[model samples]
Target: MQYNQRTDFRSREYNGRLNMGVDMRQPQPQAGSVHNDGINRQPMPPRAPKKKMGKWSRTLFATLFVVGFSVFLAFFVLESATDLFGLNKEDKQLEIVIPEGINTFQLTGILKQNGIIKQPVTFQLYAWYRSLSMPNKKYRAGTYVVNTNYSYDEIIYKLKSGSTKDETVNITFYEGMTVKEIANLLEKNNVCDADDFLEVIDKGEFNYEFMQMLTKNELRFRRLEGYIFPNTHTFYIGENPTSVAKKFLTDFDKKITDELLERMKNINMTLDETLTLASIIQKECSSVEEMKKVSSVFHNRLASGSSLPKLQSDVTINYVEDNIKPFLKVNNQKMYDAYNTYVCEGLPAGPISNPGIEAIKAALYPENTNYMYFLTDKNGKYYYAQTFAQHQKNLAAAAKAGAGVHGTTTQQ
Candidate 1:
């Protein structure tokens, strides 16, 4: 048994292999290769390098984005501007009521609600801008008629002017009407109180070149007796007294043109004196032609030296008796003497009545004549004379014609 040991070991090894059922005869697959039962195996392909965009492509994309954004922004701005400025709106009238004492914000809100404005915020901004320059300017409250197409500036101006709903009256003051008559008319029309208007006329401080030249004579009955220009005017009912007086003065200021001022200077006549004479002429004559002739007679008497120093106007006596005496608390003999041309030398202390433009012109440019006296009959016919005897004849003729005589024929 010892001599056959090597052959026995080999026989044991073969038996151990058969018992385990182990086989090591298959080939191994390489790395990174697919192995599906080790049949038809293949390797994976390598990845390609990534490509980068060129400079021009990036620039084009950025340019397109910027252009698109700019177009959108421009369109937005155009729309906002159009609405803010009230451009291209419908032309339709709209009536709107603005409540009293509403501030700028409330005003714009009302406008927006009424379709009068599209952008309230922008309108308020504009109002604030204007307020910096005109602090006193504010939108007036009341019902107003506005157009839809009006610009912001126009809308603001219209609102600031006044309300259309306030009561207004048209008063026509005729030539030769005194301040008292004017006051009575105003009170009759419910424009203002007559006493208040007279108070303003006596004391109100009016600032005008012509008014500044006036002398505040205590003897003058009213401070602005003859300066109130006669015209048709519009006034608010129950208006302020000062405001009512200013309307008449403002018109007078405009009526005294540069040419008229030069004419007054050429004739060596002060404004008060010219108005005084014009007022006399206004009351004495019945027609424009008669006014010129009467103005000539007055001028002749004024230049007559010591022979005829006093105007001796009959109208001045009428003014004292008719206008002054009735209103006086006590009979002011001194005031009567100052205004009565029969007693006072030269022109009366001031104008007796408000004269019209034609009378004023006649005072400045009198008809060239040697006539020194004039008389008017009840029929309104005028007779002129150069001598005292001739005036007496004209007076008798006037008396025979109409049973009444009117002129400066009374003894001075």
Candidate 2:
């Protein structure tokens, strides 16, 4: 091939071959320079320099990656820890029974089932951490009354200590006891002081609408007089006063169902009025059958345009006399107390006693009869009459049967 004017003929001979005898000082072609036919061509654009990394730069890159990864891992662990431990939830009093021979895994399940704890795994993890600190401390099996208000540490400590002082106390209230008497019974049982119980009954607020309505009436001797259901109750020994009242009121609410409320409404009576009549029937009657008769007599007197506008009940008068013997003679002069049904035109102001469900049902569904007079004698014999003359005859028969007249009264 013919060489161009600007071509270096010696450089062409060394192309694609090693030449040990080539001139060392020959001017080198710049990087990216273009050449064609050995003529002098335009120089190409200069390339960007390759960056060189030193020891310190490499170490900085490695440290940043490690720190970023560690921070991300720490944040993840914190989020998991929060969920595992029950934190920032509503507090409630929960009673749980932990059986004997149960492992930590099983105990965590029980606590979660009872709503005492939120997370099972978190509880286990916390328990594990605690066990590490106290190698000998372990949760004992028993009935545990735990409150959500307690912190995780407090709850864990309490479980480890095996405290059972929070056991429930049993309280029994008998039928026909007044609120005052009921308070005394609670005091005697060491459930609470009598005065404290009375204060709670008077001032404590209740959730039920029926109780809310009664709270408005200042004339009520006890706001929840007939509503404190007379039954056996088991409550935590140091239970709140409002909580104790709620237990009895809750039982009463269940007993006096919507069906019973509708019945009272059908008869054009309020709960207070119905309970008042039931209390009278409760005290006047000796048996359940007698209750129906007594309820009828009161219903007959309460009828529209009845000749006897007032219910001449001896038990109501006895209530005014503070339940004294010879109740008929205890109050010769008509008392001004509203509970004195003999003096009051209609039913008593409120319930004289906490009557049972039977009496309550009797008042709601009285025996339909024209009988306006009823008498229960000392021999437990019952006398019913439709007129004054028939009533006198029945009383004479009761006298012949060796039965004494105790609650005999004349209607005004």
* Worst lDDT 10-window in candidate 2: 323-332
- TM-scores for every candidate against the unseen true structure: 0.61, 0.58
Candidate 1, residue 325: lDDT: 90
lDDT of 2 by residue, 248-336 (tens): 88889899889999998899988988888888888887698778877888898889455787888887777766732233444434333
TM-score of model 1 vs. true structure:
0.61
* lDDT tens digits, residue span 139-232, model 1: 7788887768766755765676564434689999999999999999998987766887897898877789998768678889988899999999
Off by over 4 Å in 2: 1-164, 215-217, 304-306, 323-335, 408-412
The TM-score leader among the candidates is: 1
Angstrom error of the Cα, residue 317, model 2: value is 1.7
What TM-score should be assigned to candidate 2?
0.58
Clashes of 2: 0
lDDT of 1 at 116: 78
